[model samples]
Target: MNKTDLLKSIIERLEIDLDMIQRAAQTAYETATAEENIAENKYDTLSLEASYLATGQARRMEEIRQACKAYQQLTMRDYDPERGIQISNLVQLEDAQGNQQLLFLGPEAAGLQIGTGPSKVTVITPRSPLGQQLLGKFEGDEITLVLGNGRQVQEVVSAW
Candidate 1:
């Protein structure tokens, strides 16, 4: 799997999500301002509820827009294994059974997953536990990951 192509795919997916979020935010704002949503009775809070919902949706839309920008600005360059792990690097990890998972170190979009088949990759941030452990690590190095009640060893098969 090509790292640059996968990064482009993730950016494209984020763009699609941003468009959907914008539409939803606009619809929510319109509904909140519609006359039908006004509080007609003493016990009613329809307008207030709608306003809150619209505000939350608008905030989410802004967040997604910013995330799109961040992803777009990412430099799709190959990482030198000698330089160690860093953001914008794609790391391939192998477990005891030889199972592999591709992870992309990103500035944001920590939980986003992109691609399919062997190209599938998950975005991780430096703040994440696994990401923290992988930073400054080199290929052929092994690290023990503690997750909840279990521990597993993962080897840095490659990074680029």
Candidate 2:
């Protein structure tokens, strides 16, 4: 799949997630303030606990909303492979065994994967270990990744 197709999929997924989060957040907020959750005495903390849970849910919902907004507002730029890797670039990497993975670097939405088959794209941020290592690497460059006690080598096949 092309970048446009992958980007559309990502936005669609984010919208779905945002809707679900809003619904869940509303439910949690309502449940927390419901009469059944009211504290009966000084020792009663059920309502307080529910309120805390609701707050956390609301916070998470806000975070997801922000992420969706950031993604939607991203300007698609034409990237030159020779310019090296950067956010908004589609990169192709190959391992020693010839296994390949397509990655889309973005400012947000890290760990979000889109597409299937050979067109599958995994979203990564610069803060991630692999993303950090891939930054500034040109095509045909080999990068050594350290994972715990093992090391794996991957080559930058292409970037667009």
Candidate 3:
């Protein structure tokens, strides 16, 4: 898969999310400031709750904005096998059962899956457990990944 195309796809997904969050924030703000939502007594908290939701939505919007900026400013480069895997590297891993998984190491937006079926690629951040294990690993290297209560070993089939 082309890294440039993947980056563009990620940015497009983020932009959609940002738009949704913006709309939700606007609705929450309106609800919070509406006259009908005004608290009439100590027991009334609808306005307060709406205000809190609006604040949370706003914070999420800012986070997505920052993530978009980070991804936009990210420099895409080919991974040097001698130096091991690093961010922006597209890695393919295979399990003992012959199951294959494609992962794109990104600066942010972990858990975002692009595409479908066998072509699907999941984005993982350096801070993620699997991402941490994948770093500094070379092709054909066995990596032990911790999954919930179990551990699975997979080999790095390729990186580029």
**The best candidate in terms of lDDT:** 3
Ranking by lDDT: 3, 1, 2
Cα lDDT computed for each candidate against the true fold:
0.86, 0.84, 0.94
Q: What local lDDT score does residue 37 receive in model 1, on the 0 to 100 scale?
A: 76
Off by over 4 Å in 3: none
CA shift at 30, candidate 1, in angstroms? Answer: 1.3
TM-score of each: 0.90, 0.89, 0.96
Each candidate: how many clashes? Answer: 0, 0, 0
Better of 1 and 2 by lDDT: 1
Superior candidate under lDDT, 1 versus 3? 3
Per-residue lDDT tens digits of candidate 2, residues 1-160?
5777777888888889879878877877887898987888999887787678778888878877887888888876656666688877899999999999999988888989887798889999899998998888889999998988999999999888
Evaluation by lDDT, superior candidate among 2 and 3: 3
By the TM-score metric, which is better: model 2 or model 3? Answer: 3
The ten-residue window of minimal lDDT in model 2 covers: 75-84
Between candidates 1 and 2, which one is better according to TM-score? 1
lDDT digits (tens) for residues 43-98 of candidate 1: 88777776788899888888878878988888776777667989889999999999
Candidate 3 TM-score versus the reference: 0.96
Assess candidate 2 and give its TM-score to the true structure: 0.89
